[model samples]
Target: MLATPVVFIFGRRFFISAFRQLRHGKAGMDTLVALSTGVAYFYSVAVMLLPTFWAKKGLPGHLYFESAAVVIAFILLGKLLEMRAKGRTAADIKKLMGAQPATATVLVNDQPQIIAVRDIQVGDQLLVKPGEAIAVDGAILSGRPLINESMVTGEAIPSQKESGDSVYAGTINENTAFTMRADKVGRNTVMASIIRLVREAQGSKAPIEQLVDKIAARFVAGVLCIALLTFFIWWAFGGPAELSRGIIAVVTVLVIACPCALGLATPAALMVGIGRGATMGILIKDAAHLQKLAGVTDIVLDKTGTLTLGKPVVQEGLWLDDDRDINAGYPKSAARLLAAIERSSQHPLAEAITSYAISVYGKDYSKNNDIDFDHNANAASYINSVFLPGLGVEATLGNDVYYVGNARLMAEKNIVVNAGSEKDVSPEKPVDFLTPMRHDLTAITSFLQAHTTHTIVYFAQKSAKDNRGTLLSVMALADILKPDALLTLQRLGHQGIGLHMLTGDNEAAAALVASQTGINRYLAGQLPADKLAYIKTLQTQGKSVAMIGDGINDSAALAQADISIAMSKGSHVAMDVAGMTIVGDQLSKIADGILLSRLTGKTIRENLFWAFFYNLIGIPIAAGILYPFTGFMLNPMIAGAAMALSSICVLAASLRLRYRKLK
Candidate 1:
């Protein structure tokens, strides 16, 4: 009776919460705890106060006040341990938050002023000193800094940054000081987006957890019914001390059955797995998407931006007929015209051509040229410039039309490409007029095409009489492969995943990348629709497809795939449509993410199994099933300890995922 007051006071929360849940026609873990301890406490009080009343019924008046107190103490201790373990699961979020400094040095009116990070505004020029964290996302205006991007990229090597390069928040300026124009401040920074994504992913419930919740909802009520049935069986069948045995059985059954473990099985594993992924620069947007990543069978990769570096550079340029009268001042005039036409388009190849022209003919080539071409002074000199999606660009310059694109685009406009000595050579047909020039162009075209894997671009001028343009020059451009492309593909292939490459590039370039990467199957000349259709076809074959891309054309295909991955350096449209984003634009993270998903899935299954198995064996023994043979009956205090240990076991299983290697 002395221990009753202390037990009631310390465990009041359980009783109060159980009462509230009962009022709403629901029950939970609190309900079972309250019923067991409440029954034991009140029954002991009855025995202590009414000794004579129990003597008449041939029963000993024993007080169980100590048992009730010890049970509450054991449960509280278990809860404290579980809380500490759960805190460790979110340590990654804390580490990421710690990466941001509280204050930043801003260049206010040509002088450095220290200010709070939250006070930073867009377009503000912030100065970052050596060995300091960047204030926010911005582009470098001056000074090249070697930045340590491991906070965002998970790489140890510092990246070399120059003028016009972007720097993100939380990155360390390892080498030199630089001034930057802040483009994204506060919540608009990339680190802020990564934090938001990681939080959402950790908080989300997997599909399996939804099923567990439904089972756990009815679990408490079912355990209550079983406890009541155990009481009746003991009261009727117990040979001696039936009342004592019956009350003991009721307390033990209610205390030993644990619903907490069942509730925590899936969510605990998901939290630890997602938190670990963030540390490796893998931002998982949702738990459901991470679950889907494990079962991906075939992975469709985009040629540019995903596997190869998206930047294309000019390698070689050749003039078709240098000795012809019409080709006088050929190279210079052609370079200026090509620059003017390509400057109007937004394609990467167009940018490469424009840069090449500016480098060869100087930025202000019109000042020294005799031709009437000045792109800056007379912007309308190149008029009606149209960008054909899969073809090239078409523009008109001073009554002479020009075509700059693939061979197919040239053929569509009836332009004659006189390459090689054969009659039906290559995709473009040769004209019979310039025989000697054709032989020279043929040798050059054959050498360029056969020697290098670079993409070929043709420059042609239209004729007024035949309406067929003459091929003026050919330029070869190349997009280099990523450093980790081959290794990443090899790892994914070893894991039994089928790899396929899709691109809008021509057959020669596509074949070369495929062969170099050891990919067996590839398709070239694939437009946006063609890529989308390929993904759908793979899905129709009962194959789970994962698409990795980094362009606006890849948006539809990214959305259509079962699992879509995007490079952080890619276009916004592709990233917005993708389910997962690989930071640092590293292809190897794709394999790491898949391996993490498999580990998380395995952990969740083990947790669920242990939860169900514990309850199946524990509840019966607590109800005096063993007393019929060896005379063993579980004490209420021991039952409480066992229940607490079950939840701890589940948490420990989940925490194991944090330490597992993701290679």
Candidate 2:
């Protein structure tokens, strides 16, 4: 609706200034656009000096550019909203750091007084109350409590802690009060380190950013050269009535032919995707990872951190002596002997050992001569009479001295570990045993296939009183599966994806977790080289695999996968190899990332089609499409309108990507 070339010139000037400042300025995109808009507003006046202006209307005449004005306004407004939306993601990380109390209750001069977190010096004593954020990273000097370490693990389900246990800043004190010696203060805290990571990650550009810059440099020069040729050709072949023909064609080409939209497409989508992901509890390290993840078909998962809660739980326990029915030549009392060590154990694995015993034997365990250990004491519970002088818990029930702990415990006393019953299961040693319920992970694979758990070692030794000794039940335990493991596996399965579990955990636990989550392929008790080899095998078979891990041992495999996804809670080595990082450790977000990347790729193609089509079709016609027909020359005003509209269409096409529907 604007007045002729006046409206068109204004739009042309707008694109020129925006393109120029963005190309040359040492400012941000928002600042560049602002400065360019100002420069173009004045530059449009230059259009008046040409013959198109001198013959009729004066130099002050408007360019009459309605569409360009609309597009520029719309793009600027879209950019502002996008920036604000992304800013919320950064605020979340900062807000987490902000939650640490402004003031801390410190023991200064032996008196409790509130002071700033910065003022608390090292070696300062702090009394943490029940349900308080730990002011400083320190070791607990005294007391025991169930601390909720949701700050670190993101799992707030009350984990117990005692004296000598190390605690960090920002963890809520869930149980009794404790005295802690401040070891780290101020910037040395865990919270401080995480804040620093977020800052470093936010400011970093992806490898693709440099590629975009190179492409733009070549593209801009080429576009300008083509525009120059188009103008000269028209003047030579078709002839111009006035010198203004050169000016109109030159301005139209300069304003309309820009590669800015293409340059911004990938980065804009990346910025939005990563920022949006972080808000939903995921963090991608770079934009290239989005491109990488789109191609991944299979995912390799680590057993403990990725699939299970990583806590050892009690599943079942069997004592040989308690059973009334005999199995083969074994005694009916085999079940009771297993409970002897299981009952004395406090380990998470021991819970399963005793749990199995209680289910069969019933809960009537009473120690007539018991060692009364209280919540106040850091003590190992025992029924004193059953233990021998050196060998662990020696019960005379069947008159056998059964030992538990490690091979070192057995070697220390020079007790001969029975080879037939020993299951030596380390990736380094890899010993096999014939004993039932051996903790040695050597049989984790077979046990996993049968859906049994690892974490318990079973053995019995000869006693002088009972020289005709028997192999008694020594131990049984459980390792809890990772949290939300089943859900994660199910989500992957729903997408028709296959998952492989690569782990150093014993086969029994690894297989059990895999089965529980419906994972059919599990490689347990694997070395780092083994994991890497497996990844290579998948690669050789043309599988696009994604490896997810959270440990130093997983570095090689993580790097070997097509896309390496690192958990935010994982070790440094794992994070280093990972192409993408999940900031808040939500596995489900990975699925969302894949969907967004494909949609964005389709959008760029569609936009480029519109951009290329407008220029390719219109410029030839404006040059002289029907010179042999009616002999009516193409109007400079119409050419100007078509050129301006070309830029408008490209801008509109690119902006339409914002409305892409994501699954």
Candidate 3:
């Protein structure tokens, strides 16, 4: 129970915030106020009886009434502020529900109508106007336009989308009109999921939270026992004059050690850590991941997709032979011819080779395609490039124009080569290595075994009929590591965090990427399920693993990991699965996240120590440690002041997090 005078002093703020909260349907706040007032009044009437008891026992009225009022007032006021702060933050569930849009324009019989967001159901059609927010997750049945998904996905740039493109709520349609088929409404959308996860994470108190309760419960019980003992020793066993002093001692100990500070220890630290992590582009997701991440020792990398640029580029090409059938096998001359045709195209592989041409030959050789490749009617265009859907473009130097694309492009051009044939030059083997890759190639080894080219040479050819044939010889096409990637990997290693790679490409490519990224150990040839299985295997063996990914394919692994981190530039599915998302592509943020979590952990321990030790040791001293000889009895006010001091210590420690300056 709180003291009476303190209730009268600040009764206004409590009743106001409480009443306002109650009007908004926050019963907890109302109930808490009622409980506080009820408990306060009960204690008030008890303390009022104190002066009567003293008078009846032949003591002065002035000493008994005045001291009781002052001591109780101070402790109660401190508790009031703490309760207010807790109520504000503990509205986690409300915050989660707040992320949804309150209303949406629904399509009724093809006419737009407004309705409460909650009333909209799945399968409802919603008309999305230009320059407005998408109110729900839906697919566009019509119109093609670009979108800005920055608020939801952190992708600031506008990306174009056509009919059949899925748009998420909270994503702004930059310059297009889309009629949406609502797949998810209100709190069930992706944005709603993020809000829900954040809420759950926040409400989830750490072990420290329960520990504080344990300490407070135990300390409160023990203090009451000792106060009872103190009353018995002085009043029942001593002279009549001792009863007044015993009454003062018993109340003093109870008032001085309320356990307010102990209850706050874990929460104070948790708030600091959570706040710090949010600013650093890392969300710890839960107390368990926050604490466990600080101690991770091994990082496994998914090779092809994680480290080196997942995109493939033309490395080297050479003219091996003209009669050699440029399409028949891999040749230095064919590599260069493929490089030139790619220069004519604007596709990724085309740009890769075009860039290669500029780098090696100092000329941007892109061909202005007069027509977009549509179907077999553009079979002439098919002769020049092969499209690897998830990967990049590959070029085939053929009897026709230079072909660029996946293995399919080479086959479409009718350019088949026997892998057994050998060629001259730098790397693998077989001029026939230039053949179309088999669709059945599931593993990286299977793909490499099919390629027989040694030195990839780059060259430009005039046309298929040219006596010199389509062959441009120069340096090989390749991908290089970003200069900072290696340093990030190495530094993360120093912090005892493992770096792993993930990719959907071949193993040789995977190894090359891993080598560049400085990851010493790697696993390749994994489909999404394979990666998930690996995560489960490691977890079963008792490993604390964190999976970092930025694609839909990584969703399963992200879900199964002890900690899931998504790239801010990643797909929506990946972001949904991860515990935290980096606002930028930098992986160094992971290391920084762990540092902040550990700092919060330290603060929690410190606050608990002070809260625990204050009650553990202070109550005995406050009960008149030297009462017999020196007669140094502790007053109720001093005990109340000590209780306040413990709370202040916790608050001061937590405040330091605001200035922690994590780089």
Off by over 4 Å in 3: 1-41, 45-220, 227-235, 238-251, 278-281, 285-287, 300-402, 406-408, 411-469, 473-483, 495-506, 516-521, 527-533, 657-663
lDDT of 1: 0.73
Candidate 3: minimum summed lDDT over ten consecutive residues — where?
418-427
Candidate 2: stretches off by over 4 Å? 1-64, 67-71, 74-90, 108-110, 206-216, 231-242, 255-589, 617-663
TM-score of each: 0.54, 0.53, 0.57
Model 2 Cα lDDT, one tens digit per residue, 219-331: 45555566568667767765754345444445444444433344345545555555555665556654566655766789898876666554555453233332224344344
Q: Write the per-residue lDDT of candidate 1 for residues 1-663, one digit (tens) a residue.
A: 467665688889889988999999998767766776787788778887889977886655666666567557655654543343332225435645666889999998999999999999999999999889997999999987777664444232345687989888988886568899999998888667555544543453444446754675677788899888998898788755676777777877776774657656766777677778888898765555566789999999988778888777776777663324544434665677777777776444777888887665666454323333533446344356876544677887656688888777777876664433244543344444333334555666575656477777877777444455677777887776899999999999999999999886668778888988999889987755677789889999999899998765565677678787889887664665566789999999999999999999888789989988988899999999999999898876677678667877988999999899876
lDDT of each: 0.73, 0.55, 0.56
Which window of ten consecutive residues has the lowest lDDT sum in model 2?
371-380
Is candidate 1 or 3 superior in lDDT?
Answer: 1
Candidate 3: clashing residue pairs, number: 56
Residue 465, candidate 2: Cα error in Å is: 35
lDDT of 3 by residue, 1-663 (tens): 433455555454555655775687643322333333433344446556676776677644332232333334433544543343232223433433444467778889988899887788899988777677788888888876566654343222244566788888766765546688989876677666655444443344534336544654455456657878988888776767788777767766665565556656666666667667777777544555565566565555443223434344655443334345646554433333444456555443455655654454443334434322222223324455543332234444334444343343333433333222323321233223233333212322343344333112223333444322222233344444544567768778888776666554446755766655667666665655566677777778777788877655565566667676777665655665566676666667777877776787777788878877887677777677677779688766566567667777888888798788664
